[model samples]
Every structure is written in C-alpha cells, then in structure tokens.
Target: MSEKDQEVKDQELEEEVAELKDLEEQESVTDELTELTTKIDELDDQLLRARAEIANITNRNRNERELLQRYRSQDLAKKLLPAIDNLERAMATEVTDDQGMNLKKGVEMTLASLQQALKEEGIEEIPAAGETFDPNFHQGVQTVEASDDVPANTIVQVLQKGYKLHDRVLRPSMVVVAQ
Candidate 1:
C-alpha cells in the first residue's frame, strides 16, 4: 500500500471508532434517564398512597371522638336508672296518715328533681304503654291473649319503665304484650 493511502485509511478508521463511542455514550445516557424517570414515578405513587392513608386515619379518629363526646353521659345515666325506678315505686304507694302524706310529697319532689336532671342530660323515659311491642325497646316478660281492644304485638302493660340516654337505650322496658 502507498503511505498516503495507508494514512487516509487509518484516519477514517479512527473517526468511525469515535462515532461508535459517541453513539454508545448517547444510548447509555438515554437508558439512565429512562430509569430515573421510572423511579420518580414510583416514588410519587407511593407518596400519594401514604397521604391517602393518613387522611383516612384522621377521619376515623375524628368520628370516634365525636361519638365519645355525644355519649359521654351514658354510663352515669345507666347507673341512676334503678334509683329512679325505686322513687317511681315510692310515688305509686298509698298513704293514709298526714305524716305518710308528707313523706310521699317529699318523695314526689325528689323524683321530679331527678327526672328533670335526667332530661337536662338528654335522658328520657321510653314510652311503652299502649305502644306496639318492640324487642329493641320493650322486653316482653309475659304475653297475654289478644283482646278486641288491644291487637296482637301491642304492649298490654309496662311492668318497669325504661330510660334512654340520647339515641342509646340505657335499659329496655320490661313489659307484658298482647299476643
């Protein structure tokens, strides 16, 4: 081969090699960029999921707190039910003498005050007399034959009064049902 021809061939080969190196570098950079973009998308999705979970937890806690606040007096009201029942029983008793009458009056006043306090605290008696029998509010201890005046599943009598604190039943009414 002539010297000039050999030199020209060598220069051309070096240029091709440089072009290949540049192509490889460009391909590597593109692959690296794609990988970085995919990683960023994955991290963004994870961040969104974490935020949603935190929001759900916050809402659940708020609802629980509201329920706790609304029913705060439930326990104390339930405890006072039996005492109110006793007072109601006292009110129902017959008194013949003046002293007995005075005692009865005092009992009546005491019962009234307790009932007022309960009303103020969102506690009230369940109305069972003459109403339809309900297992949710009235517990039928005994059932009587249905009469023409009273239909089946109707409450015949309330043996003991039931009370409730707000929407929750503190106690179910003990009742006789016509069946």
Candidate 2:
C-alpha cells in the first residue's frame, strides 16, 4: 500500500476509537443517573413510612390520655364517702333534752347537706340494712341467733356502711347477720 493510503487508514482507526470512548462515557452517565433515581425513590418510601408511624404513636397517646382523664376521680371519691355516712348516722339520733335535740338537729342538717353534696359528686351509700347478707357487698361481723322473723344470713344490722364507685364496690358493708 502507498504511504498516503496507510495514513488515511490510521486516521480512520483513531476516529473510531474516539467515538467508542465517547459512547462509553455517555453510557456511564446514564447508569449514574439511573442509580441516583433509585436512591431517591427509596428515600421517599422511607419518609412516608416514618411519618405514618409517628402519626400512629400520636393517636395512641391521645387515646390513653383521654381514658386517664375519665377515671382519675374514682379513688378520691371512694376515700371521701365514709365520712359522709358517719355524719348521716349522727344526725338521725334521738335526743331527750332541748339542748341535745338542738345539737342533734344541727348535726342532722349537716349530714343531710353532706349527702346532698356527695350526690352531686356521684358518691353514694350502698343499701345494706335488713337486706340479705351478701359477701360481695357486705362483710358479716357477728352472727346473731335467728328469730322466727329473720332467716339465717339475713343482715340484722349494718355496723358500718358499704360504698360503691360507679358499678364497682369500693368498700364492703360491715354487718351483724342472723345465724
């Protein structure tokens, strides 16, 4: 071959190599772009999951707080009910002297006022006197000999009253029951 033809062939080979290199670089750029897009999609999915988890936790906490608020007064109300009962019993006593009667009447009024206040606050006495003795509501203190009128396990007297907090018995009534 002539030198001129050989030079032309060399130039043609160099041009082909350059074109191939450029195509390789373009393919690498495309691959990099695809990898970056995949990473972005993963991050978006993670962010969505995180937000949903936080929302679920927040809602759970709010529900717990509401439940606490609704039942928080139960313990306090149970503690205050006994004093109210004592006051009511004191006021109902019979007095012979004028001074004693006046004092009894005053005490009775105070007890009635306390009971009314307790009613307003959802505090109430359990009815136990002369009822059938129940271990769930009343604690039998002493067994009295049953007369013909009263059956065995009948509540002869309530020594101390029982109380309820809503539907639950807070304190069982202390009673003397018929044998």
Candidate 3:
C-alpha cells in the first residue's frame, strides 16, 4: 500500500476508536446518573415512612396520657364507696327521739354531699334495680322465679350498690335476679 493511503487509513481507524470511547463514556455516565436517582428515591421513601411512624407513636402516647388523666381518680373513688354505703345504711335506720332524728338528718346530709363529690369526680352508682341484669355490672347472689311483671334476666333488687369511674366498673352491684 502507498504511505499516504496507509497513513489515512490509520487516522480513520483512530477516529473511529475515539468515537466508540466517547459513546461508552456517555453510556457509563447515564447509567451512573440513573443509579444515583434510584438511590435518592429509596432514601426519600424511607424518610417518609420514618416520619409516619413517628407521628403514629406520638398520637398513641397522647391518647394514653388522656386516658390516664381521665381515670386518675379511680383508685380513691373505689376506696370511698364502702363509706358512702355505710352512710346510706345509717340513713335507713329509724329515729324515735329528737337527738336521734337530728343525727339521722346529719347522716342524710353527709351522704348527699359524698354522692355529689363522687359525681363530680366522675364516679357514679350503677343502675341495677328493675333494669335488665348484666353480668358485667351486676352480680346475682340470689335468683327468683320469673313472674309476669319481672321477666328472666331482670334485676329484682340491688343488695349492695355498685359504683363506676367513667366507663370502668369499680365494683359490681350485688343483686337478686328473676330467672
């Protein structure tokens, strides 16, 4: 081959090689960019998930604190129930003379005040007499035959009063049930 022709062929081959290298470098750069973009997307998704989890935890803690605050007086109210019952029993006693009548009047006032205080604290008496008996709130110690006036599962009488604090029962009512 002639020298000039050989030189020209060599130059053409070098230019082609350079073009291939440029194309490969561009492809590598594009692949690297796509990988970086995918990594960033994954990191963003993880960040969002972590934020949602933190929000859920915060909400749960708030709800728990509210419940605790709402029922804070449960233990003390439960302890006071027997004292109120005693006062009620005292009120029920017969008084013959002036001193006895005065004492009974005082007992009635005390019982009323105690009940008011309990009501203010969200403690309340459970309704049992003449209502449908619920095992959750009433304990049937005795059973009587069902009559036309009182159906089965009805509470005939409450022997001892039941009390509750908010939605939670502090004590169940001891009752007689018609069966």
Candidate 4:
C-alpha cells in the first residue's frame, strides 16, 4: 500500500477506537448493534471493570472517613476517667437520708443528669437482670447453686454493670451465676 493509504488506515483505526470508547461508556455496544459493536462490547466489559474498581475505592474511602468520625471522641474521653472516678466516689459516700431531703434530691438530680449525658454519647449499661447467662457479655466472678426456677447457668446477681459502644464491648458486666 502507498504511504498515504497507510496514513488513512491509521486515522480510521483511531476513529474506531474513539467510537468504541464512547459506546462502551453508554453500554450500548452489543452483538445486536453490529459486529464491530460486539468487539466494542468486549472493550466495554473492561471499561465496566475499571469503573467498578474506581467506585469500590471511593466507597472504601467514605467508609474509612465515617469510622474515623465515629471513634474521634475515644481519646479525649479516656483522659477524663480519673475525674469521673473521683466524682463517683464522692457521690457514693455523700448519699444519706439524714442530709435533709433537699440534699438527697440534689445528688439524685446530679446523678441523673450525668447519666443522661453519657446516654446521649451512646454509653449504655449492659442488661444484667433476668437475662440468660452469656460469657461474652458477662464476667462470672462466682457461681452459686441454682434452684429449679432460675435454671442452671443463669444470672443470679450483678456485681457491676458493663457497657457497649456501637455493638462493641467497652466492658463486660461482673456477675454471679447459678450453676
């Protein structure tokens, strides 16, 4: 072939590739469109795969951002524990019916407000009463002999409460169980 014919063929091939790329994007190239479109569909399949890969990467990045946002407060809250411990100790010792009804009322109100604040942040006490025993949620410190009504391996008493954050265990409840 003449050099001019070769140049024309190259231009035609380039145009064909560009057309295929466009068809692939619209997903309109198929066996029914034409034989050339069938080959375009093969290229389209690869294009589809590449697009899907990019979409997956975008979704993964979004998920990571959401997870970071969710756990952002964990570090700050860890630092505040000692003050909370002191407050609880003081509250426990200060409780009395002799401090006058107003003092008792004030303390109860303070405790309720504190609990409400924690609840808003997704901190909740693990259920301990009248539920089936679970080693995962409960730390069994002791086992007591059981009667027929309670059943063997059932929870009898809760020594301390546990907590969860978004389906993850922050702590396990300490309990006594029937065995």
Best-to-worst ranking by lDDT: 3, 1, 2, 4
Tens-digit per-residue lDDT, 1-80, candidate 1: 99999999999999999999999999999999999999999999999999999999999999999999888889988999
Each candidate's clash count: 0, 0, 0, 0
User: Which lDDT tens digits does candidate 4 get at residues 126-159?
Assistant: 7986777888899999999889898888888987
Predicted structure 4, TM vs. truth: 0.58
Tens digits of per-residue lDDT, candidate 3, 1-179, equal 99999999999999999999999999999999999999999999999999999999999999999999999999888889889989988887998999999999899889989999999989998999999999899999999999999999999989999998888999999999999
Worst 10 residues of 3 by lDDT: 85-94
- Candidate 1 ranges with C-alpha deviation above 4 Å: 96-102
Name the runs in model 2 displaced over 4 angstroms: 1-35, 126-159, 174-179
Please give each candidate's TM-score: 0.87, 0.58, 0.84, 0.58
- Overall lDDT per candidate, in order of appearance: 0.94, 0.83, 0.95, 0.75
Residue 3's lDDT in candidate 4: 100
> Candidate 2, residue 2: CA error in Å?
7.3
- Ten-residue region with minimum lDDT total, candidate 2: 115-124
Q: What is the alpha-carbon RMSD of candidate 3 to the true structure?
A: 2.3
